[model samples]
Target: ACTVARQKSDLFHKYALRNAANLLKPEAYLKPLEQKIKNVSSILKNKEETVLNAWHYRKKIIDEYLQYISFKRNTDKVFVWIDEHDECFVSKLEELDINDEGYMDFVRALK
Candidate 1:
């Protein structure tokens, strides 16, 4: 039972991170957000150690993540992804509606 609970929690975090990775500002939040998520795995290794549960932890992480993304915007920097072929892909962070079918298809192709 305990093992199953841990497995479920691990799966939840994995999916959460995967969803976050596809977000527009993911380049800014990925590293620190990953560190925050590692806390979940840490607790599974040592149950006696107290760690934030998934809900509270995820909310806190999201709040901080949004702040981090917003902070980057103030710097007036545009994130560009360069492929192995040396092709540059430029994106406008604020303009991304996250609902564009064409853009989603392009992103899938890039992966």
Candidate 2:
């Protein structure tokens, strides 16, 4: 899903670059703003597989934790909770640490 989201964002970037009527756009704007292309380049680069795996792992954990706690709150704010502490949720929960890092890390790394 993170891959998809990045792809979609890149798609949008491509389209916008194609249709851009003004200055170069975000990338262009960022470069001079930062006075460094490397900074902007790093931001634009796809994440390493390890980082992407970590994010996927993080997402899976939050999703499970959300499901686990959904009924307890009147108006569940699952996304925020998931976002804030996914590391812990990923680190300890069975669903999140599916890899059995003695935890859920395995599950998160699957795909």
Compose the digit string of candidate 1's lDDT tens values, residues 18-73.
88778998757667766665776566656623334555788999999999989888
Task: Provide the global lDDT of candidate 2 against the true structure.
Answer: 0.58
Cα error, candidate 1, residue 3 (Å): 2.4
lDDT of 2 by residue, 65-103 (tens): 998777656345665676677777655665432444533
Task: Tell me the RMSD of model 1 versus the true structure.
Answer: 27.7
- lDDT value, candidate 1, whole model: 0.63
Error of 1 at 104 (Å): 98
